[model samples]
Target: MIKVYKSDKAPEKLAEAGYTCDEVKQAILNDQKDKCYLCERKVTTDYQVEHIVSRTNNKEKVNEWENLFLACNYCNDRKKHYYDDIPLPNQLEFENVISQTINLKTQKADFRISKINPQLAKLKELLDKLFNGKGICRNLMENRFWNDFMSVYRNFLRRVAAYKIDPTEENKQLVIEELSIEQSALGFKYAFLNKDAELWSEFQDYCKWNK
Candidate 1:
C-alpha cells in the first residue's frame, strides 16, 4: 500500500446526490491513484468509496474528505464497519513500515514489519487481519494475491527473456532497475526467480548498491 494524498478542494461532506457524486468520486480516485488503499490493487471503474473510520463508530466523519478512500469490492466488503487503531497509510510511510515476501510456487505474499518500531508492528498486525482474516474465503484471498503477483511476475519474465536474447550489460541493468522498483511495490516475485540465480544475484547486488 502507498500513502495517498487528499486534495485541498475536496468536499467536506458527501454530495446531495449521495455517494454517487462524480466530483467526489473523481477526487477520491485522483488521490488514490486509482488503487485500493489497503491492497494496492488497481481499481478502474468498479470501486467503493470506503471510509477509513467507519460511520458506525464516527458518523460525523462519514463524509469527511480525510476519512474517504478508494477500495476494491473484496477489501470493501471485508472491511465493512470494522475499525482498527492502526495508523492509516496517509499517516505513515508505507515502504518503510512493511515488507512483503512471496512464495514463487504458491504466489502467496507474507507481510512483515520492516523495522523494530512498535507502531510498525501494529501496522503489520492490522495488515495480517485484513489479508488473512476470516472476512474473505482463504482460497479467494490466496487467488487474489497470486493473480496480482503473477501479473507483475509475467512482466519480469518477459524482461528476462529480452535480456537472454541479447546478453548485453545495458539490457541486464535495465531489467535490474525495473525489477527493483517492482519488487518495492509488488513484493519479491521478480527477485525470487530461482531459475536465473546468477541474474537474481546481480539484481540483489544492484539493489544494495542503490540503497
Candidate 2:
C-alpha cells in the first residue's frame, strides 16, 4: 500500500525532501534492487507502490508516508490515491549538498535535483569535464563553438599557409568564410561578434576538405 505525506503540521522540510509518488517508487527499486518487499521475488515485471489508504478519500493527505507500501504490478494497480507514498525516512536525505541547487540569478523559480551521493574522488575527476570542457565554456564565452571545431580547423589553417589554395581569388571575403554546426546554430554568419573565429573556421574547413 502507498502512503501519503500530508498534514497541517507537515513542515516544508518534509515536503522538500519528498519526491512525487513516482519518485518514491523509483527510490524503492533503486534502494531495494527491484525485489518485491513482501514476497521477495526476483520480479522481472514492472511494479507499483500500493496505497494502504485510498487518496481520493483524502486528496489533501496524499504525501503521507504511513499510507503506502511497495507493491508488485500484480498486487498494486489503480487502487486509489496511490500518490501519497513517500520514500523511507532514511532514504530522504534533505541536507546533502548534491540533492539540489539554486539558480537564483536566472530563474524566479527554484530548481531541485536528486542523485546518488557522489564520491569525492569521482567528483574531482569530473571537474575537468565541467570546468575545462568545451560545452561548459561555449556558453560562458558567449555561445562560441570551442575546441572540437577549432582543432580540425587549426590543421586546415596550417595547410592554407603552406600553399595558396585560392589561386584565382585575390582577397579573402569576410562575408564568405567557413562555419560549423556550432556557429551556424548560433546564427553568427556575419561573424559580427567574432570575425576571427569565422576566418579560422572557414579557412580550416576549406583546407581540410576543399582539396
Q: What is the TM-score of each candidate against the true structure?
A: 0.67, 0.26
The reply for model 1, stretches above 4 Å from the true place, is 12-20, 115-122, 129-137, 141-145, 157-211
- Per-residue CA lDDT of candidate 1, range 128-202, in tens? 665555545557665666576467666766777788788798888757765443242333433344336877665
Error of 1 at 7 (Å): 1.6
- Candidate 2, residues 1-211, lDDT tens digits: the string is 0111222243343366553445565655554345433222334556665444456676555666554445555334422343233233123322222111212254111212235434322322222222234253435432222333244334434434433445334334322342321111111122222235634454544322101
lDDT of 1 at 28: 80
Q: Which ten residues in a row have the lowest lDDT in candidate 1?
A: 181-190
- Residue pairs with backbone overlap in model 1: none
Model 2, TM vs. native: 0.26
* Whole-model Cα lDDT of every candidate shown, in order: 0.63, 0.35
